[model samples]
Target: MKIALIAHDKKKQDIVNFTIAYTEILKQHTLFATGTTGKRISDATGLEIHRFQSGPLGGDQQIGARIADNEMDLVIFFRDPLTAQPHEPDISALMRLSDVYQIPLVTNLGGAEVMIRALDAGFFDWRKLQD
Candidate 1:
């Protein structure tokens, strides 16, 4: 399964910590992430990640494209609700694409944990059949 990861500046550390805690399960599948978040996660977990541009620089749109094309099965986007983003449209588009594509999307730590646990349990294997 291909998992797309994105994190706002404030939530990057949380995403990194979460990835570290679930590195074993995460390592079993392909990983993709936005620029700084990808580097942070790779550094913390030592997991290879395909990196896109920074979110404001078009990374969110890139991931949205992948979701639309059915190239991604899961998306974990740790957004800081209190903070305003310059590329809000990109973020919104990504969320809409996930919904339209029927992909699992995690927008907070709690949701991310649930999705990660499900991934660990192999709940995402059904995606292979659909592919």
Candidate 2:
């Protein structure tokens, strides 16, 4: 499975911790992330991640492109809803594309935990049919 990891500034630590906790399962799959988030996770968990530009600089769009192409399977985005984001439109578009493509996307830590577990349990095997 191809998983995309993304997080807002305030939620970076939380996502990093999540990645650390799930490193074993995560390491078995291909990972992609935005610039800073990818660096932080790679540094903390030693997981290899394909990094794209920072979100505000076009990372969201890059990931969205993959979703549109049906190249991405799961998206774990730790969004900081309480804060105002400068690139709100891009973020919205990313989420919208996830929905449009029927990709599994989780926005909070709890949901992410469940999704990661599901991934480990082979719940995402259905994604292979789309290919």
lDDT winner among the candidates? 2
Q: Write the per-residue lDDT of candidate 1 for residues 10-101, one digit (tens) a residue.
A: 99999999999999989988999999999999998899999999999999999999988889988999999999999999999999999898
- Badly placed stretches (over 4 Å) of model 1 are 126-131
The local lDDT score (0 to 100) that residue 11 gets in candidate 1 is 97
Backbone clashes for every candidate come to: 0, 0
lDDT of 2 by residue, 25-98 (tens): 99999999999999999999999999999999999999999999999999999999999999999999999999
Backbone clashes in candidate 2 total 0
Q: Pick the candidate with the highest TM-score.
A: 2
Those runs of model 2 whose alpha carbons end farther than 4 Å from true positions after fitting are 128-131
* TM-score of every candidate relative to the true structure: 0.94, 0.96
